[model samples]
Target: MLVVDDNSNPFEMSCAIEIFGLARPELGRELYDFRLCAAEPETRMRDGFFTLTGVAGPEAAESADTLIVPNRPDTHVPRSQRVLDVIRRAHARGARLVGFCSGAFTLAEAGLLDGRRAACHWMWADAFRARFPRVRLEADVLFVDDGDILTASGSASALDLGLHLVRRDHGAEIANHVSRRLVFAAHRDGGQRQFVERPVPAVPDESLGPLLAWAQERLGEPLTVSGLAARAAVSPATLHRRFRNQLGTTPLAWLTGERVALACRLIERGEERLDVVAARSGLGTAANLRARLRRETGLSPSAYRKRFGAGPAQPTAAGGSGP
Candidate 1:
């Protein structure tokens, strides 16, 4: 994988290098062969305070299986044709293309995202729309995975996409292991919103913080709106209003999401029996777990476990343990 650096954000660059470039021998497989690339003579990031040298040129990307554009020089500033040509050549040769944040601008400018479902930071939706009307932008998403092409909204979404690629190539187990190594969620669907906090009030603004924690530990128990509100010492409607204002989502939706997240962890830990996984994750029945997993991850219990399950933790659904 080659990460194309074009006078951009250091944080986004670090996000990629940390996930794809760093070695994780603990996973027992060589994952990505990540590298950095520069198409020109001037080698400084966007701020010009951080200087990058010894970066490989475009020719290096030609052989890589994947190519990434971390960000554009600026959404409004035009890129040199020479750089665009190199990026196009990389795509033409069958390398997977990735663009995150304003990097989508580079893809759009190159005409790659034209008519394709793509994403960029939501705040840039209007600018992106005005600049590249041909692109079918899904601005609300955390990222977009269009087979050969992948794009992310911004910030941690960059990590989500990198981990997503890891999951794509090596399966969920390896991705989860790498995610655990980096302390990140192994998967956050591209359809999820880019930001939840509207700002003047924080997510912690007397916002069901304790109730959420309480519900997390008791997902197996029946959780109701009234029960949750009672525990928080507020009326159900007040709880709903507060959740909407502070979390940007409802309590039930948040609870279900948390349950799905827990199921992911249980599955990743390689629990063999679907029923056991279902029981412990508090989704109850295997059928219910199946339904929820598909809704959340677009994968079945067996399939999700297969992609993400790890270690000699439990007996196989068909029969025996890994060891």
Candidate 2:
């Protein structure tokens, strides 16, 4: 993996480093041969936060299997022709491409994102669509995984995309380990809405943390929206509103997502029987598990198991036994 830096934002760049560049000796193997490349020898970072130097030149991008494009704060500023040329060549050679935040602009400017689905920061959605009308922009998503190319909606969503890439390259168990090390959620559906009613509520709103934790532990049970509402001492309508305001999803959607995730982990841990996996994950029946797994992962139960089941057991981040 190579990060192409051309006056990029430090936060998104750091997210790439943290997710792909960092060594995972705890896992007993390196995840990626990560490197940083720049179009110029001395590149000024976003808002002049700092100057980056001592990185490989643009030529390094040609050898990388994956290229992470730059995300600059000034979206209106035209990217350097040299940088654009490098991205174009890399894409021509079939290397996986990534864009974080305004990096979507850089990819689209290079003419790689036209006629392809992508995501960018919601604040720039209109401008991106206006500038590149051919690209199918999913402004509501946290990220878009269009096979070889991916884009993230915001600076923080960069981590979400990075973890997703890790899960794609490795497996759910390994991705869970890496996410645990970062103290982040193991998975956030790419289709989840990026917008929130209020980033920081003017008045403190009731937190759903306790309720969420309670529900996670009971996913194997016959959990229902009414049951969750009852547990929270709130009406079903109030629970739905809170879920939408705080989590950007409905309670039913969140519950279904959790159950699917649990099913995936169980499968990755070498559970062979579909009926057993379904029951343990609260999916109820093998037929339902098959449908939900295929919808969420694009793989049937047996296929998913075949891909992720043969790996050695990975230890937990807290030095605990593997699940």
Candidate 3:
């Protein structure tokens, strides 16, 4: 992985370094051969915060399997032609590309995102659309994963997209490990809204943290929207509104997503019987598990297991063979 630094924002650049560049000794292996390269020998950071020096030159992007483009504070300023040319060449060579915040502008300027779906800071939604009418800009979502090209919306969402890329490349368990190290959520679906209308309610609302924890602990108990509402001492309608406002999703969608995640973890832990895994995860039947897992993970249960399963099945709590 190579970070193409051209007046990059420190937060987003640091996110890429933390997620992909840092060594994961706990996982007992290096995740990537990470490097930082710039078009100039000494590039100034965003807002003239500091000078970045001693990094590789633009040519280093040629050998990288993945290239992370720069996102600067001034979106109006055009990127250097040399940087754009490097991005175009990297894409042409089939290297994966990432854009954090206004970095989408860099990719679009290079003509790589002409017909691709992407995301950028919500504040720049109008400018991004007006300038690059050809690209499909999803300003509402935290990130857009359009195959080889991925773009993240705000500074923090860069971490979300980075974790997602980690999940895609190394699977759920490893991604969870990385998230744990960062003290962040293991997963936040790309479809979730990037901007919540009231990030903090004008009047303090009851936090759903305890309720969510309760639901997660009981994911295998055939949970439902109404049931969760009742548990939270609220009506179903109120629950739905709260979910939309606070979680950026409906209650049912959150429940389903949790169950699917539980199902994936089970598979990773060597669950072999689809029916048992489904029932334990509250997905009900093997068929339902298959559909949900594939929809969420882009891989069937067997395929996911083959890719992420730890080892042979161990004994179950009931003194029987593991699922």
Candidate 4:
């Protein structure tokens, strides 16, 4: 992995390092040869005034099978030509490139994201779309995996994308194992939004916690937007507005995501009958589940199961086991 730094959010940088760098080799399926590469030899991060020790610099990127650009401090900083050149060269060599959060701006500046769909922090979605209008932007998604290039939405979505890379490289089992080790859910359905409507408060405000908990416990039941709105004691329009403001999506979209996530769990556990999976996920029928999955991921439910449900230890971009 090649982690580019521009003195951005050290917390996100550290999250990548801890998950992909400091993860226990003994616990991990195999030792990961991860590197913290940069445009400069030595970079100073904001965390603890810690000056990161020098690595091999941009030249080190040449040997990497995958490159990761972490979130930058400023999204508007013009990428140096030298930095863009390294990224383009590495990409030309078939190396998989990942841009987490605002790091997508770097890849966009390098021109790798031209005509490609990408994921960026939704708060800056309009600016990114206006700046790179040629690039197809998927705002409602947590990430976009376009062939050799992958980009993640803001914040924790990076973890989801990172784990996805691991699953792709090794297998689902290993990815799940590593995720368990990290205390994060192994999968968060790639189709899920980067931020949900009515997220639980940061300081345990619990204003929407009870409602979310109640909804989660009954995903298999019919969940209409009006019904959900009623549970929150608000009109459907009010609920809709709240959903947009908090989660960046509608209630129906959020419910479908939860159902899809449930279906993934079922398939991973070896439920092959499409009807059974659909019913369990509250997607109603096989056709509905198939349509939703295809719309969300451009893949059929069966294909997804074949690729991700069969194995655990596969090699992914995150350096865990997956394929």
The C-alpha local distance difference test score for the whole of candidate 4 amounts to 0.73
lDDT of 3 by residue, 263-307 (tens): 888888887999999999999999999999888878999999887
Candidate 4 local lDDT, 69-99, one digit each (tens): 6567567778678778877887898788888
Per-residue lDDT tens digits for candidate 2, residues 230-316, read 998889998898888877889999999889888988998889999999999999999999999988878898888887786754322
Q: In model 4, where is the ten-residue run with the lowest total lDDT?
A: 314-323
TM-score of each: 0.79, 0.91, 0.92, 0.75
lDDT per residue as tens, model 1, 140-253: 878998878889998889998888777656555566788888887665667667876544644354656678768989987888889999998879998887776555567887
Question: Each candidate: what lDDT?
Answer: 0.74, 0.83, 0.83, 0.73
Candidate 4 accuracy as TM-score: 0.75
- Candidate 2 residue 196 Cα shift, in angstroms, is 1.3
For the record, the alpha-carbon RMSD of candidate 1 to the native fold, in angstroms, is: 6.2
Q: C-alpha displacement of 63 in model 2, angstroms?
A: 2.2
**Number of the predicted model whose TM-score against the real structure is largest:** 3
> Which residue pairs collide in model 2, if any?
none
Cα RMSDs of all predictions? 6.2, 4.7, 6.7, 4.6
Query: Would you list the rank order by lDDT, best first?
Result: 2, 3, 1, 4
lDDT of 3: 0.83
Measured with C-alpha atoms, the lDDT of residue 231 in candidate 3 is 89
Rank by TM-score (best first): 3, 2, 1, 4
